[model samples]
Target chain A: MRPLFVSGLCIASALGAGLEESFAALRNGTSGLRPNDFEPFPHPTWIGRVDGLESAPVTGALARFDCRNNRLAQLALAQDGFEQAVARARERHGAARIAVLLGTTTSGILETELAYRRSAETERLLAARDYAATHGMFSLAEFVRARLGLEGPAATVSNACASSAKVFAQAARLIEAGICDAAVVGGVDSLCLTTLYGFRSLELLSAEPCRPCDERRDGLSIGEAGGFALLEKAPGAKAAAALLGYGESSDGYHMSSPHPGGAGALLAMSDALARAGVRPGEVDYVNLHGTGTPANDRAEDAAVHALFGAATPASSTKGWTGHTLGAAGIVEAAISVLCLERGFLPGTLNTGRPDPALRSRVVLESEQRPLSRVLSNSFGFGGNNCSLLFGRAG
Target chain B: MMRVFLHGVGVVGPGLENWAACREVVSGRAPWGEAALRVPVPAMLPLTERRRCNAASRLALAAAEDAIGAGDWPAVGLATVFASADGDGAVTHALCQSFAAREPEVSPTQFHNSVHNAPAGYWGIATRSARPSTSLAADQDSFAAGLFEAALQATLEPGPVLLVAFDLPLPHPLALMRPRRHGLAVALLLGREPRGGALAALALRLEPEAMASPLPPALEALGDNPTARALPLLALLARGEQGEVRLGAVGARQLVARCEQ
Candidate 1:
């Protein structure tokens, strides 16, 4: 498999809107999760939410696509000049040659929720023509495609948590298949009541800031974020960390809970390493899916320990940015690249005591280590799992 | 170039139920059937699991089972690509209604089924497949998007891949915006190597949509549903005709599947 370099990237999470801000928060052991402050939801749970989405409205011709999700995407696209980087890619690869693949679980479904409420209150449906355009599942991708003026293949992957991580694999395949030379890949999921109460209804929301790998870890702290990266064939444009390989699998066990034995997780991790032609011993760090849910943490701990043993430093960045649902993949992928560039591994931010029974080494504090290879895991509902291997570009 | 052998096909919609039954109607050999909006469940799924699956999931699973049953292919290692324009609208509407109430409360089952990949998850659970699956959306171009994704995936793996594209109507206020949706599920079993039930070879390319005659009235009516974008692709596979149809966006970049048999 050929490598795709993430030449350009930007992230807007609860940690702040820039690379330096995120790096500083990670290096300083600062957390982004806090108690329930976001309004509109009755659930009393902590969350990681970005700022300005509620007060800031997306202006310009793209105004009709305005929503919490699209606003986050627009803001992230403008940060760190990611849109400019995409503009350059448009020139290098031709506007028609660059593809846009994003991921999200609820793409402006909040707008629908709001619309339904308004209709229920007023006894009539809104006649706006762009309601479907702004609220459909593909709305975010279409908005991003138009924002970047990309004419190549564009689609949104919605496989829950594994969504964006799988986009990296798809970009490689599409490029390797001669479909496109460059792709703008990422995900955006803004905080919404649907996610808040939906997870609450499922009893998967943590009442406190998430404590990943903690002995008493309970459930996840939901979050909202938007992140994107430009992937190009290696020799054309190089970055410190490049995507070496990715492996994907489904559990065949349960819809929500992972296979207790981590069967799918092991398959995904092993597949990624095998495809990358790297031994497990060579991986310096791992970013676990570690949603803080007891079932997920234990299952992932078993999978990681089995593959890399207790050597590689591993932690869940979800403690920093609450699990962003579909956006978790890209957000964590960018963080993995940052780990290789910064030459340090991030630790679980809010965890105090790591589970003793788990054989994997769950780092509690950030460590400055010369890291080369990193593996990021994203497992979604319905047992879908993807493991991505990232490394220095030689 | 991407080439996949269409080993088997499955489809379920209004009046048309299974592959063998739907084939006759799609190829213009029989009258198109009509039934109520309720999705029918075949015996492939057990009662316990079937009861848990929503209409959208059941529709997708039924179509997938039709293909798997017809191809007689092992489902254990199959890769799945589930594409839908809109996810489970019934569940989503229920959630919205719940939220609108004085107290917002969505059922746990509804919450889990709300994820777009719920159908694919059920597919994995029912088939006991440990293989990977992707769920995606491309609006009106979902059929083409799923085909593109599936063809690319099949090119890399040795085993056959499952491509299931489905959509159900949006309820009420949401329905007014997307007024054309109907319950429809279409499945295709694609493989690079020949299998026993292999039907025809297909090569897919993205190109400008060609000016051509509109489909017959009956087939054109099927286009009201987003998943019916596969109507032309189905015609090619079912009739053993060497042809290509425009997919994806109507005027923008489109997927053209040329039957190379």
Candidate 2:
């Protein structure tokens, strides 16, 4: 895999609007987790909702595509001058030579839910005008491409949680294949009824702020977020990090549940390490895909323990962002890059006590540290697993 | 830089069941009629896994089975790419209705099967293949995207790649809003080297496509369903012709497949 340099990146998550806000929150050990305000759920659970997005309008021709998900994408793109960065990339690669790949689970499904309720009363589906276009899985990527004025190759990955992370690899392949010179790869998933209730049906939504790796952690705190990174074939002089390598594997054990032994996770981690040419001893830190679910954390611990043992500093940042579903990959990837750039090991916030049986050193406290290489893991439903390695260029 | 050979092809569309049947219809030898719009359940799936599959999953798996045939489908290291314009519309519709219910307790089965990769997951379980798989959506242009990803895997990975693109019309409320009209799926088994069951060879290059020849009405109907967007290329491959047919758009360009017998 050639070095696909990340030229610019931004995220609008529960942590806040831009890179500075998110970085500052992480640096100060602040948890973005808050009590639920999303309607129609009876159970008391924590959520990582991005605020003021309802009024975060998409202007001009892109207005018809507006939904919570696309709005979040717009918010994130506006932050950190990501939209401006894209303009420069378009100038560099020519707008037609860039690709757009995004990931999302419930993309604009909320609009459909609203439409469904209206149609159920009217007995007509025409009320949901753009439902046919936006509700489909590819809507976000199409909307983002239009918003950024990119005409290159485009697609949306919706492999549950690993969606966005896998886009990085996809972008790398297309560029390496010479199909494109640069790409905007990321994911967006906004809050919707399907996920809030769906996770509850699976009994996987924590009632409290998610405490990843905590012994008493019950389930994940769902979050909505959008994020992006501009990956170019050549690194700009100011480029801080590059997508070193990525490993993908499937559990094949269960559709919803992970492999109890973390077999797939281990395979992905090893493959990513081998691909990145980084050794276990060299990884400065690992951002675990700790959803705070008992089975997920324990299984991931087994895999992490097998690779890095109890030595490498590791933590699950889900505590801050909740589990952003499809956006988890890019959000955490951005955070991992931030960790490499900012020089710190982010602690597993809100955890009272780390799991006693885990062998890996779970970072329960924020600490300053020099870092070179970091591995961020994202595991999704259907046992889809992806491990991404990020590092500073030599 | 590399010429990828197509080992096997599978297809399930309105009136055709597999590549052999699809070839007959696309070659103008058989009457191309309106689709029954009914996708048969994939017999390759185990009984336990059957209940977990929806129309889209069945459509995808059935096409994958046709492409795989009696040859070996390695249970390991086979990367799968599943693409769809509309993913699990049935589940989306059901989930939406559930939200309307007084007590919205989504069935665990529906919830798990709702992922866009549901068919891909079932593919892993049915074949006992724990290899990596990705599910992507490109709306109307999914076939081109799926082919691009599959070809990339074929060139990069050591193992053979399976590419399945499928989609199905949603039940009312949603379908009335955005009607797909037909349920369809197609598959291609690709590898760097042709194996025993190899069908035809092809060199796929990516470039901007000028509107070449207009599609015949029968084939034009195929375009309405995203998976069926591969019909033009499929016609060329099935004819065993050594000519080029545009595989539609990818990035800023289209996939120009030069098929060879």
Local distance difference test, each candidate: 0.84, 0.85
* Alpha-carbon deviation at B63 in model 2, angstroms: 0.7
Model 2 lDDT, residue A96, Cα: 84
Residues A1-394 of candidate 2 have per-residue lDDT tens digits of 7777889899999999999999999988887888999776898999999999888777688878877888899899999988888898898888888999999988888878866656446345445467635677888988988888998889999899999999988888878888789999999998888888889999999999999999899999999999999999885447888888999999987888898889999999998889878899999999999999999999999999999998999999998889999999999999998999989889999998998988899999998888999999999998899999999865
Q: What's the TM-score of every candidate structure?
A: 0.97, 0.97
Clashes of each: 2, 2
Where is model 2 more than 4 Å wrong at Cα?
A119-128, B35-38, B210-216
Cα lDDT, model 2, residue A39: 75
Best by DockQ: 2
Model 2 docking category: medium
Q: What is the lDDT of residue B2 in candidate 2?
A: 46
lDDT (tens digit, per residue) of candidate 1 on A1-394:
7778888899999998978888899998888988888866666789898988888888898888888899999888888778888888888888777888999999988766776676444224444646545778788889999888998888899999899899988888889888788999999988877888888878889888999999988899999999998998853555777899999999988878999989899999999998899999999999999999999999999999899889988999999999999899999998999989989899898899998978898998888988999999999998999999999877
List candidate 1 stretches off by more than 4 Å. Answer: A122-126, A235-237, B210-213
Best by lDDT: 2
